[model samples]
Each structure stands twice: as structure tokens, then as C-alpha cells.
Target chain A: MAILDPTTAPRRSQLNQRHVSSHALFKELGSNLVVSHYGDNDSIIEEHSQAQTLAICDLSTLPRIGFKGAGAPSWVEAQKLNLPAMANTTVLQGSGSLVAKLSDQEILVLSDIFAQSKDVFHLSEQAKIYHKNYDKQVYSLPRDDSHCWLAVSGTLASEMFSKICGVDLRTHKFSHSHIAQTSVAKTNAVVIRNDLGSTPVFYVLSDISGVEFLWDCLLDAMQEYGGYAVGVSALQRLTKEH
Target chain B: MKLLTCPLNGKRNISEFTYGGEYHAMPDHLTSSPRDWAEHVFFHDNVAGIVTEWWCHTASSFWFLAERNTITDEVIRTFKADEIYQQRVEFTAVASETQS
Candidate 1:
């Protein structure tokens, strides 16, 4: 296949320059371009192995949206989306997206790793539709532009996090449903655990402007464990039958 | 590293919070003089004893009240802003009246 240009996408990741520098191969994911694989690196099989041990992937271009305000919880529940009983916990919608409550009023929704789920888009549309009814007080927060999403996966992923984060994120300490809103590498980030089948995967959402620094920081810390960047294709394999 | 407990997010590294100045009862917006407003916005008591102050959790932007001793720099307790600010305070611009 011919090398695709990320620049062609209307929406692009903030780390596009860094990815381009690292020989990243572009692929379309939900109207945005993401790194399918870093060209000149190991094949997807090798990348899959690297991911099982320690790997970082930029998911900045994936589908994600946030809602906040007094009426958000009820409004979300009205859409038939199952919500976690408490804040700082996440639950998978039977339709496939993940919903994470940041507070009593705020929640963030992310698409399935396969990028096949349209739950986020539907929620976004719902918010727009009901926005005319000011009674709901639910406000839409389009996170795709405001925040960058990155996923760190592997058996040693939690160990790698300790190097930069102040919070204890060990698998024994922080479970898959837990969320940590704290300082990481001196930058504020919302950390959510959503493992890939058996392997642990933590999703970090931070200010988009600071994403480049965070990305570089994660890559630098993971170097000691021979961690490398992988693509979505490799991550998908982790969730399926091996 | 110092640790600060956020009323909403629970305990977190002190670095995760931004001190939003001392919490003070707001003078009635329509009744207070310009000087009173200026003092309320700019001047802090800087008390040496325990005092309530405004703090924001940087990651979640959760604003809450914290009682801390200024001299010792120890936080006594943290609680949600709703404890005191139950009603919304609206500031409407009187543009039409002022246009004259």
C-alpha cells in the first residue's frame, strides 16, 4: 500500500509532526488520521509482542467526547447508556463505547478500540438535539480538540507509569475501572484504566498543547524496558484471540 | 512532596492544586462600593491562623474550600464549594441603563 499523508485529514493529531519524524504510517480512524504503524520498525507481529510487554500508542485522533453540568448524568442515562455507580469509574456500554465519570457532573465517553462504535457520535448528536431545552443544563465538551489521548499498554505498563506519575497505578492498586485525576510529569492529566484483555492498558488524557511533551516523556521512560510505539492494528490483536 | 486532599477528587499531590486565594464572603454586588469590591478582589487577610481558602484541582478543575493554617502551611480540611455557595451568583451587565 502507498504511504498515506496525515495532512490530508481535516482533523489531525497534535503529535503529527513527531509521528511524521518517526516514519509513522497513516491510517484513517473515525475521520482522523492516526499512526497505523511506524514504518521501518518491526512488523505488526513484532509490535504486538512489544505491546504485550511495554508499548505506547497515540490515540489522540480517536472518538472521544465529554459532558458536564447538573443534568448530564440523567441525560446520559436517558440515552440507555449504562453508567458506573460512582465517579472515577468507567463502564462499557453494551453498544461498545466506554463511559467514564470524572465527577458528579462530568463524564467522558470514548469509542471502542476497533473504532467501530458510534456511541460517542450518537451522544454528541443527542446533546446537540437537546441543547435547545435549557432545562437539562447539560453542556457538551468536545474533547477531540481540547485533549490528547494516549494509551500505555503491557505487563510493565504500570511500572512505567510510576516513573512519571505521582499516583500509585499498579494493577494491584488501581483496577481497570478506576480513574486518576492528578499530576503526571508535572502536567495535569486524567488517567483511566481500560485493559486490553489480559494485558493492562492505561489511557492518559491531558491538555492537547502539552501532549507532545507528555508523549516524549512516556517514550523516554519506557526506553529502559525496551518499550516502543505500536499502532492500533497491533492493539486490536491484543483484545482478540491470540 | 506535599499532599493536599481535594474534597471531590480525594487526596492528591499538592502539585495538582492551584491556590485560588482566600475565600471571603462577597459583598452584595449592587450595594458594595468600588473600594470594597477592589479590596475583596485583591486583598487577602493573610491570617496566621486557620483560614478558609479557595483551591482548584488542576486536573479536574474542581474548585473547593480548604481550611489551612497560614504560618504552618498545614491544611485542616477540605470541602466542596457547594457547602457555602448553594445558590448561583449572577452578574448582569446593566448596559441599557449605563448607555445614557
Candidate 2:
């Protein structure tokens, strides 16, 4: 069945379109990547760059915001630390705990139920006020299209990615905390760190119009991994499959 | 990329950091020196020479007590957080040491 394709229509007031729920968003993206929405801006597709993995998502169809400065961590921690305020040079630990709650000035603890909590708006406001004394700014933007996530692992995955997507993965030049909006085949994806260390997280975000095209590109890239495209059911049933 | 050169580490990206604010923004509530407090709180010389500043190395997870030249943005000496200040001693001891 065809998903909601918005690229072709390009409506003027598109930010008002429906949102992809956290359950469906995570369920659809599979297990390779942990998924969650931040604030009312759901368009953000941020994930830990662990190993040689790729996390694809339909976040373009959501909303997003950017917060920068020294107080960024403190402000973010004011509510929850699920997203630890690591140095711009660092990345989150792989599989340790993807979810976090911001408890104090310098602490972010892993929280179990913080993900589904609906009080993000209230918390964000308080954090923003606290941020005023320090140099911090947050930018919230809603996306106009749906996003898709793909997490690819293994040694050759980087080489495969370089072939599928024209990006320079030469370790010294590009490392973690670096992001670029580039092309993967004919589609657009923001390729980031696939490894929490120096590896890269190949985040491919495209409009629904390019879904089929991206899917084909991914299959070709993963052909050597015995990688077959799987749905949420198959992803959830991986433990059983193994 | 606003670059700040650490006297110890040479030049590096500014992203691996946490701004420590003006040279001395110590809270007024802690110390009561109507004159000393005024100078520390409101009066900043903005000198060009080496200055002591607090810099949290977010990447290294360490706080740096750096001697930075504010005008050139050159960090002269960088030390660990603990090394920035001496171990806590009684006020009398500090006064005696200064006198001696």
C-alpha cells in the first residue's frame, strides 16, 4: 500500500499535517535505531552514531528544533537527560540507554517512562526561561514530509555507503558530532555519525516521493550483508528468527 | 567556528567547550566587600594581557583553569579543575602565609 506521499502536492500550510505517533514511528523504523519525538517539533531525526550502523526514519514528516550554547545541556537537563548533553565532539553510548532524563545541572539519568511523557511542552518552557541567564538558543521547526530510518552495520557498510552515497568517510576529515545534508543516490539524506566513536550513522531522510527510490538504494547497498528489507513485524521477531 | 587557542593545546575548535562567562562573575551574595564586590561584579578591565578564566572542557569532561589572553584569544596555560585553586585552608592560615 502507498503511504502518505506529500512531496508531489507541496501544500502551502503543510506543517499542520498529521503527526506520526511515537509507537508507529519507532515500530516502523525497526530495532536498529531507537526512535522518539522531541517537543512539538517532530521533524528532528537524531540518533546515536554507534558502530557502522545506519538509522533511517520518516522524520521529515514531523517537526524539529535546535538548541545551542553552553547552557544547552543545563536547559535540556532541566526537563530530561534522555539526550545527554555531551560535548559536540562526543556521541551517546551504544545500547547502554538511549532514553534519558535531565535531573540537575550536570546530570542526565536514564528514565524508563520519560519517552511517552506528554509534559515536554511544560518542561521546555521552564528550561527556556532558565536558559535566559546563560547563552542558549533553541530553534523549533516542523517538517513538511515523512521520514524513514535505516541502520546498517558491519565493516563493509561504510564502503557500501560511500558507493551508494557520495560522502567522504575518510576518518581524519569527518568524525562524530558532524552533520551534512547530502545526496544518497538521487534522494536526500542527512548522513551523520554511524559510530558512537568515529564510525558514522547514515541517516537517510527523504520525502515520501523518494521512498521507493531510497528503498531500492538501500537494498542495493545492503545486498552484500544478506540484508533483506524487513517490516516492523520482522524487526520485532528478529530474536525469534535468530 | 570561533577559534580559541589554548596556550597549552595550541589551536583547536571552539565546539569542544562550555563558556564560563566573564573573567569573574562570582556571586555577590557569597562575598561582602562593597568595594571588592563592586570591582569583581561590575568593573571589568577587559585587558589585553593574560587573564585567568574558567573553561569547562565538555569533550574531555574536565574543567580547565586556563591563562587566556582575552585580546588575542590565546590560552597560555591550562590546568585541571582541581589545580586551579589551592586546597581549602583556614582564613587565618591564608592571612599568615600572605604576611610571611
Candidate 3:
């Protein structure tokens, strides 16, 4: 069933709801915020929550591209500080995970969400090239998409996410690069599984308006785990250490 | 964070944009007055599903019309404003008829 069109997709759950939280992300024992989830995996979320009670979502906004052609490898290498492995190689050549030239500038390269040392350099380099050749305009992103990214962390992270999205949360099967375009509480979203060794992270990408409902559904499912909500400001304090 | 791709360039985030509202449709300029122009700039008729909006590439200084589904944030289509507007008059008529 199409996630975007509810009429086409069967509705097994309500669209709007919110999870209850006894404390704010900042008010928690350690650094944490309980407000809304910005989409990020645990490596990204740990920035907000600290104590075992609080959970955080990674809010690193990244860029994406669809590209292909002979110039692909050169284009990808040119954009990144450490060139990626050849188009089909299983290994990722670069040391810095912060910068991702997913595919060549031609193939679809979903760049890393967070801005690291290299993203800035690529932006400036592209801009310089564009200036040199006014005829050829270069496209680069300064901010990630304004998508409401939600993360369900803690021991119950997968359980909470499964409650919202029908897809399985088994760790081994749905690793990175494994994407599921599904629905959560009547809203369409792209769920990506980010493995964080001990606790697996789920990246839920959806509209801002649907965030309240999405958060609520997740909290309800996670109620058994005694989960709490956190806001973006609180996330900053949580991530300060990292 | 809004990520957009120009047909000319490649992937770009939405921060480089000013969402102008559904694109590929004209203001009925032949029958429209200055008031219509003002309304187009100041007013809006928000829809729940698919919509076309004008996006000004603030960083690149280019403008294009993007067809985006508001609910999903998925871009349905996009085109250069200068080239597409000429045909928008006819496109608007067809779109209005479909809505009715």
C-alpha cells in the first residue's frame, strides 16, 4: 500500500498523538531534552540524551544526489577530501565517515547529514568553480532538509519503532543502506536503520506537522519501556560532550 | 533543512530556497489586475497534497518552479521559471479543470 495515500493504504493506527514526559530534555538527570525528535541515528542522537532514562535522535542534515556517467568517479573523488572506493567496491576508502559523496556526482550520493570539516570545503570549492564558469551553475546544500527526524533509542528503541512502523526492526537484516519507505501513524516516511553496536537507531523522515503524531505513537508503543520525550535545545546540551 | 536539486546543477538543501508556492500556473494576467499581483505575493491557498511552488535559489540567484507534495516533502516535478511560465497559462487551465 502507498504510505502517502491513506485511502490507498489501510489504516491500522491513528494519525495524531503525543507521548507523555515527566521531565524536559534539559531537566533530566544528565544533559537531555524532551520535546521533539529530529531524525538521526544514535551516533547523531547521543548529542542530546545522557542518562539511561533519556533517548535522543540524530539531527544531522545531509545532502543527496542522483548521478551516473564516466565522469562519476572523478566527480566523487573531486568532491570528497578522501576519495570514496570505486563505484562498485564493497569497501569505503575514506577515513572520515563525516563526509559522504554517496555515489559519483552523477549517481545518487546521499551525503552525510552533519556538516563536518570536509562538507564546508566542498561547498566553497563548488562555489568557486561556479563563479569561474558562470555558464555552468553548481548546486550545493548548506543545510540538510527540514525533515522531522525522529529516533527511538534505548533498549526499547527497536520495539518503539516497530510500534510506529510495521516493518521489522531486526538488527542483522536491516543494516545501513537498508531503507524502507513505509508509514508511521498514517504519515509517509523513509525509515533507515543505523547500527550503533549495542543499541540500534531508527531514522524516521517525515513532515514537521506529523511530528507530534509520530512522536505520540512512538511514545505509546514505548510506554512499557518508560520512555521520555526531549526537545532540540536539550539535544544540544546532550551532545556537547561529543 | 530542505534539500533541493536544480536540473542544471545537482543536489542542494532547501536553505538555499524561498518556497514561492505551486509553480507552472499563471495569474491570469490578461484578466488580472495589480491587485491580483499583490495577492499572488501576499496571499496563499494551501493544499494538503501535491503542489507546485516557485523556489528562488537564493545562493545561486536562479528561480525554478518545483512540483512538491506538501505532506511527503517529495518533489513531483521542477522546471525553469522563465521557460515554463510561457506555457503555464495553458497548464493552469488544465489544472483548474482537473480540480473541478
Candidate 4:
């Protein structure tokens, strides 16, 4: 098989430069390119273990979309998406997509790691096809171009987040599928708790323009806990365990 | 860092908030004089005691009303703007022309 170059992929992460400098092996997920792992082929298992301890993975290239405004809730429901009962909560759909209710009138949809879920893609396509048919008050927010998504996982993830974020993200305080919209390292971001299997994972989304700064800040905060970056494969492996 | 509770987003570091200004009831644009418009838009009471003010959660962009003691720097309470603004107020061109 020919090795795929991330630079030539249809979509790439904003931290592509950082991954390239770290000797990252790239793989294609859907049409997007993401880091498969770092180091030699034999190190993938080691990376998976490292992920259980502490690791950050870039999922910025994944499919994610948002809708907001007065009619957003009913409009999303009409599309067969189940929303969380309250604001700042999330619901994992049977279709493998996750819907996060940011507020009564806003919801963000994210695709599963394997890229098997077509909910995000479908929502976007539906909007494009039925722009006039949908509720006028329900507007689409294409987060792929506006926000950069990163996943911080493992046992020490919360401890690392405390260094920069104001929210109390300790497992007990912030459970799975809970959302926090606050400042992290002085940059505004949305932190959502979405565990992968038994591993505690928090997805952080921030302005794409300031992603490099936020990435550096997160890395610096995690350094004291001996945390480092892993690749998507490590995360994919974690989900298979327990 | 000081903490402030947002009506919608809960408590957060003060740095995450932007002080919009004192919350003032809008003047009747069609009948109010130019001086009223100037005072409403460009000036502030800067009250020394407890007063209602506007604050926005920078992260969520959620704006709410806060009653605080300016002297003690203590926030008395926070509430959603909807509590006071029950209906949408639109200014028509006629109102704009009257103000002009």
C-alpha cells in the first residue's frame, strides 16, 4: 500500500506542523488525514499504553456541525436527533453520533472516532439541500472551519486541565457528556467530557485561529503530569479495551 | 482571581467576563430629545452603591444583569436579561428620523 501524505489529504488539522515535526505517522479517516501514531511501527502498543496514562490527540479534522437560534431544538428533533434534556449536557445517539446541547436553542453534533457516523455530514448536507425548507430561525454553524477540536484523555487529563481551565473537571464534578464553556489559559473554549470506553476523555474546542496557542498552553500544562501527544490509533485502541 | 456567576453558564473566573456597562431603560426615541439619546448611549451613572449593570460571559457570549456594590466590589446577585426584557423592542425608521 502506498503511504498517504497528510498534506495532500482533503482536510488536515491546524496543528499539522506540530505533528509533522514530531515524526507522526499519518492515516486517512474518511476524507480527512489524522496522526496515526508517533515513533516506529513497534511503538503503537506503547503509545496505546501511554494514552491510558496521559495523552492529547488532535481530532480537529473530524466532522462536527452546530445549529443555533430559536428554532434549533425543534428543527434538530425533526431530523430524528435526540437532544439532551438540559443545557450543558450531551446524548450519544444509537447512530454513533453525539449531540451536545449547549443551550436550549443551540446544539453541537460530532461524529464518532471511526468516522462511521454520517450524522454530522448528513446534517450539513440536509441544510444545503433544504435551505429554504428548514426553519428560518434555525441557522447552521459549520464548526469545521471555525473551531479546532482536541481530545485530552487518560487518568491524569483532569489534573492537567486544572492548570489552565477554571472549571472543575474532576471526574466526580464533571461527569460524562457534561459541557463547560469557560476560559482555558485565558482563551475562551468549550470543554466537553466524552469518555472513550473506560478512559476519561475531554474534548476541547476553541477558535481555530488561536488553536496553536491553545495547543501550546495545553501541552505546557500537561508537562508536569508527564503527559504527551498520542495519535488517533492510540485512542481507537483504548476504546477496544473494557 | 475573583469569580462571577453567569445567569446561564454558572460561576467563572472574572477574567472570562466583559463588563458591558450600566443597564439602563431605553428612552422613548420618538419623543426624547437629542440630549436624552446622548446621555443614554454615551454616559454612565458610575453609581457608588449597589446598581444593576450588564455583563457578558466572554466564552459563551451570554449577557446578563448583575447587581453589585461598586464600592465593596461585591456582586449582590446575577439574573438573566430576559427577566426584564420580556418583549423585543424594535426601532422603526420613523423613530430613527425623529431622533435624527
Candidate 5:
């Protein structure tokens, strides 16, 4: 008997074939595949274009995990995890990952660059240690499949968000590493202010099932701002620039 | 839209929190009768004056204690439940050590 390879299984993002343009280029990321670029391989045009307008990119493939229960804070502390002490705040860890303290008892861990790397697996294993030690007091909630993530960036990003969100997300008000759980386009979403590149960026996480609907709604809102979709290649380039 | 101050999340829209009703002491389950347990679980004083209650922020799932005036629907203060519980435990430990 042989173990099954999860990567070989058919896996697609919520946007999948529906959002891919005629000239889009696709690539595999872990078990799932997503659009690497809308058309250009270098993403130079996309990067330059986004400098003035807004760009929305799907990040559903990123690794995300949730820690909850009364003992979560202590458990995280015992693991020597560097997280913000206050709730609803996100801190960028030494590894370039994010540890968001949603509440005293709940936290969300996200990694953009090392989702498929051994570092992420190490973090997961460390979490398991606490889970085993505090069996009844802590619970782990894997969110890779439960939420659809989008990275919206550029100068006009805030303007585009204003159309869908009620909160004041201007840089002065929201600031860096601030997290808000509010309605976006009439759907509940968690908006985290973590800029990508030199431009302002927000990572929006919403229910996985409602991703397509939310994406369509966001695209419609982006149209007026002359916003367009960028693929993971462009997103990677932006991250590298910063 | 009304806002509620979550001790953890700061001031958030009231819609983000779920009212958990008035807080009351729970009778010791090992000693208390079934009627007492049921009363504690099913009944609330519904007081008009200042009262303490539990509230949960839906997004972060953070639960905290809120002191409010039912008559005015005004929140007086909010605090974390864990901090209060930890204080009580420490107090009990200190008292026990002194007695011993």
C-alpha cells in the first residue's frame, strides 16, 4: 500500500478558471495552483501600473492557522512565540510572518512567503506540542481552507476599500499592523493593515464559500478606481522590493 | 450604529458583540439541587439598575465582563474575565498561605 499525495488531487482557488484572463499564466503553489501573471511574465508593467492605481490579488494559498480557547495566550507564550500583547493587533515576527492577536483566547498566524516551506511546518509542529500538553485547554483551527484571502495594494487602495467598508482605513487612522473584523461588501471579513512594497496594502480574509461573490463585488468596486487584478508574480515582486 | 468597548478590541460596533445576559453566581454543582441549578441557568433578575454581564465579540471570539445600567443601556466598564479569575486565584492562594 502507498500513501496518497494530496498535491496530485484537484485543487483550485475560488477565483480559479472564472477570474483568469485570456492571456493569464498559471502556476502551481503547493497542492493548489493559481494565476502567476495576467499576461506578462516579468510583471514589470503590472508593478508600474499598480504604483498609481489599485491591484487586487488572491492569496488564498497562503498558510493560515488559528489558535483558540482559554489557555491560548499561555500556550503561545510557553512556545516562545513573539506575538503582540494586545488584542486585535498584528505583529510581524522575525521570520517575516504575522502573528495576530485577535483576542486573549484567539490568535491567527499567517505566512505569505513561507507557506510551503519547512519553517511553516515547524511552526505547526510547535503548535502541536502545546496542543498535546494542554489537551483540554487549547484548540487549533486550521484556516487554510476556511477563508479566502486577498491582498489589495497601491495608492488608491484605501479609496477602493472605502466603497465597500464602513471603517476609516486611511493610513493615519488604521496605521500599520492594525486588524479589523468588519463587514466588506456586506460580508464579514477580517481586514489587516500589512503593506506590501512601498505602497499601502491590506490583507482581506473572508469566508471561503463566499469568495467568488466577494471577488466579483470587489472587482465591480475596483472598476471605478481604475483598479485591476494582479497575479502572484506581481505580488512577489512587490514584496521583494520592500 | 451603537458601539461597545471591547477591552481587547477597543471600541467596535455593537453588532460585533453578542449579549450574554446578566452574570450570576453558579451554585456548586456537587451540592446544589437540580432546581437550584435550573434556576441559575434559566432565570435572570433583569434588574433595571447597574448590572454585570458577559459579552462576546463575535469576530475575535473574545469574552469579557461588562458592567452596564439596564435602565439606560449605558455601558459602565469592561474587563477581561481571565484577569479577574487570576486575581481571585492569587488572593485565595495568599490567604491560604497566611492561614497555614
Candidate 6:
């Protein structure tokens, strides 16, 4: 008899069913089958080509969670989480993980660390402990299943975003570690500026159900700037080089 | 786009906030007449001068008070209500401690 590993099962993204036929290579990344590359070439060439151009990668499989309510601030503080004191700011903690204070009461934590390390999971588990201990005002807002995360980066990234976003997101106006909870592509989305390499990169978080529509809208905008879709492997390499 | 200064997320578009109506004192239901209660509930002076009003940021759900002029629609200032309330509570606590 063979032992079955449940964790090895390939999890799918919201756009998985729609994009499965389009991808040429699929890699299992932490229980998720993500596109390793789209065409014949390897992800390295794809990454190198995107050095001056734009590349949009789906990162919905990343471990992300939210904390909100009156006691959320204190709870986060108690946990000794590395978050900014002011709202609309982000802090990088434990490898490439980001902790964003969307507001005084609401927080969004994203684990961008390479290889989906145990360190990020440990940080997320601390929130569960806080929820168990302080169940009064602090509320758990798990976003893993609710949000579709995307990484849009490269030289013309800001230009592509300007087409859909209302706010000015140029590096001069919106620097690294800044967050904007505004309309993107006519939809409510949270945009965070966490650059990858020398290129400007942003993490866009929106409703999971609208992921396909948002992806199409973004790709349409990227078309004018010669942008294309890159796999998660290429994105990981870009972040590592930074 | 009209910009409203949020107490937390400073200077955001007015569309991002929801108007919470005028801020006024509630009539004492026990001592006041029905007419007074009705006036408190339905009537508004709609003054052209600067008046305090309630506003909430839709994204963050942060409720705050803004002083604005109805005529020019100019927002004079904006601040968190809890900040003022906390100060009052601290002052009262200090006063009681001094008296004791």
C-alpha cells in the first residue's frame, strides 16, 4: 500500500481553471499548481527579457491574512509584529514578508518570502493564538480564499497602472512601503508598493471572484506597454536579485 | 475631485468617504416633548457658516468629525471623535483624583 500525501495535492488559483489551457508548464508550489512558464523558453530568459518591460504574475497562492477590529492594533503590537505605526504604510519582516497597516484598525499581512518558508507560517499562526486568547474585540479576517493577489512589475509598471488607477503611483509620489486602498481598473483594490529588484513592483489585492476580469483588464492595459505574463518562478528570481 | 482630509489616511477623494449627516445633541427623551424629539431627529439648521458634521471613510470605516461651511462647502478641519473623548475622560479622571 502506498501512503498518500494530502499536502502534495495541487491547489488551484481562482483563475486556474481559466488559464490552465494557456500555460505550457505547471509546477507544484506549496500545494498549488502555478504556471512555471507560458512559452517554450525557460523562466530565466523570460525574467531577463522582463528587466526593462512589464510582467504581471499571479501570486494568489501566497499565504495572506488580515486582522481587523478595535483591538487589532493592540493585538498586533502584543504579538510584536513588525508593522508601521501609521496607517497606509508597509514594513518588510522575516525575509520578504510584508505587513501592511491598511488603517488604524485593519491590517493585511502578505508572505512574499521565497519558497514559502515555515517562518512566514509561524508568523501567521501567532494570529491564531491571539484570536484564541483575546476573542473579545479582535476579529480574524482571513484573506487567503477571499482575495486574488497579483504582482505587477518592471519599468513601465507605473504607466500601466495609471490607465486603471486614479491616484498617482509614480515612485516620487508613492515610494516603497506605501499602501493605497483605492480604485484600480474601476474596482476596489488595495495596491502596495513593494519593489522587486531595481524595477518598480506592486501587489494588487482584489476580490477573488473578480480575479479573471481584473487579470484581463490588467493585461489589456499592459498590451500598450509591451507587457506580458510571467510565471511565479520568474518573479521569485527577480525578487532574489533585488 | 474634492479632497477630504481623513484623520488617519490624510487627504483622500471625497468619493471615498460617506457623509454621516450633521452632528447635533440629542434631545432628552424623558424631559423633552415629542416635537423637540422630532426637531432633533428631522430638522437641521443647514447653516451656511462652519458647522460640525460626521463623516466616515468607506475603506477604513473610520468615523470622524469635520467642521465645514455649507455655503462654500469648505472643510475647515477634521479630527477623530475618540481623540477628543479620550482627552475629556483623562481630564475628568485627573480632576476626580485631585478632589480625592
| C-alpha TM-scores of all predictions | 0.93, 0.35, 0.41, 0.92, 0.83, 0.81
Score chain A of each prediction against the true chain A by TM-score and list the results.
0.96, 0.44, 0.51, 0.97, 0.86, 0.88
lDDT of 2 by residue, B1-96 (tens): 665543233344566457664466354444566788787766777777888777764422345667788777776766654454443222332233
| Model 3 error, position A27 (Å) | 13
Model 1 C-alpha lDDT per residue in residues A1-242, reported as the tens digit of each score: 56778878887788888888888887777676778888754677888888899999999889999999888898888988888999999998876789999998898999988788898889988887798776646889999889999999999999988999989999999998899998778888999999887888899999999998999999999999999888887788889843
Per-residue alpha-carbon lDDT of model 4 for B16-98, expressed as tens digits? 99999999999998889999999999999988999999999989878899999999999999998889987557686672344
DockQ of each: 0.74, 0.03, 0.02, 0.71, 0.33, 0.30
lDDT of 4 by residue, A1-242 (tens): 24668878887788999999998888788888878898677878988988888889999999999998778888789889999999999999998889999887788999988888889988998888767676467889999999999999999999988888879999999999999999889888999998988999999999999999998988888888888999899999988878
Question: Best lDDT goes to which candidate?
Answer: 4
Q: Each prediction's Cα lDDT score?
A: 0.88, 0.41, 0.46, 0.89, 0.75, 0.76
Q: How should the candidates be ordered by lDDT, best one leading?
A: 4, 1, 6, 5, 3, 2
For model 3, chain A alone compared with the true chain A gives a TM-score of 0.51
Identify the superior model by TM-score, candidate 1 or candidate 3. Answer: 1
Best candidate, TM-score-wise?
1
Docking class of 4: medium
Tell me how far the alpha carbon of residue A27 in candidate 5 is from the true structure, in angstroms, after superposition: 2.2
State the TM-score, rounded to 2 decimals, of chain A in model 1: 0.96
* Residue range B2-100, candidate 1, lDDT tens digits: 989987788888888898999999998778999999999999988889999999998899999999998888888999988897756788665666554
Query: What 10-residue stretch in candidate 4 chain A is worst by lDDT?
Result: A129-138
RMSD of 5: 6.7
> Residue-wise lDDT of candidate 5 within A194-232, one digit each (tens)?
876666888898899999898889889989888877766
Error of 1 at B12 (Å): 1.9
* Local accuracy of candidate 2 as per-residue lDDT tens digits, A1-242: 22323333333112213222222322212112222332222322222221224323233322222343335454554554346343222234333322221111222211111123223333446656764664323322212233443444333456667676544644455564444344567465544443423333343444556665676677676676544332222222222221
- The Cα error of candidate 1 at residue A108, in Å, is 0.7
